[model samples]
Target: MSSFDLTEDQQDCLQELINVAMGQASDQLARYLDTFVYLKVPSIEQVKSEHLFETLNQDLKATAVVSQGFFGYEGIRGEALLMYQPQDSHRLADLLGYEADELTFDEQIIDLSSILTTTFLNVFASQIDNQMSYSAPRLLSANQGTISEHLNQQSFNWDLALKVRISYQVTDYSFNCDMVLLIPEEAINNIKAVIDRILEDF
Candidate 1:
């Protein structure tokens, strides 16, 4: 089997691609919420499934996580998770113009996750000349446990995951969230091939 790791050139190419995609997603999100969105540089790396959450630089304590699965051509597939810190939930509710009731809050969380996941992945897939389909976004945990604990309970078919981490913050508001893409080992080779073709074209 091919190695899951990407070459330096492939990594650079993929990161650039994701940067462009994220820019578009950020624009759409800003328009949707009528607020400026701040984005951090996205990082991509391969990590053991067990150490997934540990790789993040941010403290993910008391997070509410929503996960959605997406698949595309060339075996490009993975699960995308949007994690929100509960402390910002009220701010998010305010931005959405919704009451901070539990039911409405939960519904808005899923709605926001769906928007972020679909918009980002759709742009990313289009860049690679592919289309993606998504599964319903489900809430994994709601301010109940650590992000690591929530993920540990779930089973992953692959040992290694290509994790792409992107963080978003709304200007002048404490609303912040992290979007993570977990691509299995088997899909890494496919992604590498696609990156190679893109590099060749440039």
Candidate 2:
């Protein structure tokens, strides 16, 4: 069995690949909202399941969370957590020219999560020559407790997970969200193999 570790070089390659995918996702978001979307550099790390909430708490405080599960060829599978602050819904709805009613607010949250998760994962999977499928984006929490609180309430089966942290912000608007992609331990070897192949081709 392959050790559950990513070397420095592998980590760099993965981060670069994620950066490209995130750039594409940002472009799609910009087109959807007709506004400039600023993207922070994405960070990747291995985190134990027990410490997931602590890692999330260090990032941002979130009041809303959308969860989407994705699977890819070669055992690459995980869940993506899209978290937003309380004010994000109102700001996003305003950008979309919506009145921010209950119905529209929920719709906008799902819509944004779908766009970000699908676009980003599709591009990333393509780089690894993998086909991807996703579950419907479900709103897990809204106006709830802190991000850590909501995250702790869920159950994670893996002992360790590869966490890819991504953030998006819109200039001139107080709108921002954090996305955490958690890849379970079972898929680490498969991902490392793919990365190794890509490194060889270079």
Candidate 3:
């Protein structure tokens, strides 16, 4: 039971919208990994920038990171961060027959990440966009140290942002992926508007 600037209806809409986005991600993952992929009922949260790692530390420590962003028609909107356990990501890479070195700069690797980003966010943004018409999202990320430092150095407006946690599970495997969805504080009102729209649709 946590308090948020968003109303209960907003939260529910966010959940439903994420469900659709997760489905899109799973579809892309299944095709890309050449294995069946499924997702759990994703969990959402709102937290400060400094507490990000602490909030998701337990779920993130074991995973290799794969993240991107979600933009809407209005412009740069929110971000999407995905983390897969090392073993699982390694298995996925191997399943795709990618060598260790190939994972970083290979054409397939680049295309895969891009495709995942485009597909996942396009659907996600669209769902939320239907309500508030968010601007298009641009994906961003780097290695663990870089990502951590980048966020740490930035000045954040806490009042306007929210953190959405989306967890994924493979239908035929024991692997799990946790996705962190974040929107800046200034965009919080827009996000809530999208959530409200979703709730109305329901």
TM-score of each: 0.91, 0.90, 0.68
Clashes of 2: 0
lDDT by residue for model 1 (1-202), tens: 2377888899899999999998988898788888888779998888886677678535666889999999999999999999888877777666775666745778888988888889899989999999999999999878787877876777766689899989888866777898999898888888888999999999
Q: Best candidate, TM-score-wise?
A: 1
Query: For model 3, where is the 10-residue window of minimal lDDT?
Result: 131-140
Per-residue lDDT tens digits for candidate 3, residues 160-181, read 3577776656655465656667
User: Order of candidates by TM-score, top first?
Assistant: 1, 2, 3
Over 4 Å off, model 2? 59-62, 96-102
Instruction: Mark the regions of model 3 whose C-alpha exceeds 4 Å error after superposition.
Output: 1-4, 97-116, 128-160, 171-174, 197-202
TM-score of 1: 0.91
CA lDDT scores, all candidates in order: 0.85, 0.83, 0.59
C-alpha lDDT (0 to 100) for residue 123 of candidate 1: 88
lDDT score for residue 36 of model 1:
84
